[model samples]
Target: MEFSPIRILGIDPGLRTTGFGVIEAQGQSRVYVASGCIRSGEGSLPERLHVLLKGVREVCDHYRPQQAAIEQVFVNVNPQSTLLLGQARGAAISALVLAGLPVAEYTALQVKQAVVGNGHAAKEQVSHMVQRLLSLNGEPQADAADALACALAHASHATGGLATVGMKSRRGRWVSL
Candidate 1:
């Protein structure tokens, strides 16, 4: 049986700021419902991770999304920063899993290409396209908007079969959610 449209939450994870957006897919259309960021104050990595986890849990509870899409960490020149960011991402994912939600991961390039039609598009260009495609009323913050764009992109591409398929994993496989 064909399932009803699914709600999806997207996350752009960082140690200091983790952005999040929620979207719903219905037939051929996807709508951006909400977007925001989790701001972690200066603290130890573990403390920041705790904040990230709590923030993600709050988002999940508020949105009640069927699945989540998170941007994979890109290779940064700073190894230490990259590792910390990865930890933050892990915390976010853990929260989703604990909340009984599935998760899908996408690279930065994939997110940019899915939202802007170009993997190498500038941040402003991507943000602009996201606003236009999602039909947002006002400009969203760069990080939050990008997170929402990632969620929308996942919904569109997964529904369109441009990304991964099959949704059996507990972590949530990349499917049209």
Candidate 2:
């Protein structure tokens, strides 16, 4: 079989700051390319969303990732906060779509489980694990680390049917939700 590297972009979307990470995978080996957070100044919702969209598009343009994955927005204590977060996610997805990238969605639980071996993993745990997994010089910021974890999860999902595909392993191992 021919071998080709799969480049993936992972996004953690937020109203004030949107984090993005890129990775290249070939076979079981994965390499981190770049990661950063796009911060939007104090502004209205529309303006913030616009900033997020532009940042995402710029990352897509620069990295040229073949695929993209984003963290799913979960409900917050405040309904308004949840709604705003969802809107930010929508803006991020729209930017990826406009760039013609196939986007995959994964929940925060999945990302945490994949990276830190627990659904209730803390942010610091994620940052530490992401640094080890990607062989980074140091732990990334929380947002960027979360984005990198999303990319790592997508790489794993593509290689094996852990969550998205729901396929069984040769040893008949299954991922418990």
Candidate 3:
């Protein structure tokens, strides 16, 4: 069997610092292309959202990814904070859609399980696993690592990597088989 390479962009949206990672998934291989953070420095809510929107658009233009994956926002104890994060996520998704890329969303638990074999994996564990999976020389920053994990999760789901590893998707979620 053969498969064409797919360039994927992943985003971890935040009000202050949004992280982005690019990867190429070909068959069973996942190659790291780039990763970085877009710091939406001190600013008003709208201003910060604008920065995130613009930054994500630029990343899409520069990387020319065919697909995108983003972390789904979880409800925080603070309603206001959750709302703000949702807005940031919306900005990122808007950029991806405007760029004509198919976007996928994954929960933090799903990403952790796909990348580190543990749904409850710690941030450090996720970072280490991402470094190993992508053959990165050093551990990426926390945000970038998370974005990479999201991309990896999508790649697994898209390329049947999960099934090869004794996992299966059921009802829009991955279940270990």
Model 3 scores worst on lDDT over the 10 consecutive residues at 163-172
Best by lDDT: 3
RMSD, one per candidate, in order: 4.7, 3.7, 2.3
On a 0 to 100 scale, what is the lDDT of residue 134 in model 1? 81
User: What lDDT score belongs to each candidate, Candidate 1 first?
Assistant: 0.83, 0.86, 0.91
lDDT, ranked from best to worst: 3, 2, 1
In order, how many clashes per candidate?
Answer: 0, 0, 0
RMSD versus native structure for model 2: 3.7
Tens digit per residue, CA lDDT, model 2, 44-147 = 98998999999999999999999999998988999999998899999999999999999998888888877777878889999999998889999888788888
Per-residue CA lDDT of model 1 for 70-154, tens digit only, reads: 9988878999988888899999999999999878888777787777777788999888887888888777898898898779777
TM-score between candidate 3 and the true structure: 0.93
TM-score against native, each model: 0.88, 0.91, 0.93
lDDT score for candidate 2 against the true structure: 0.86
lDDT of 3 at 100: 92
lDDT of 2 at 156: 81
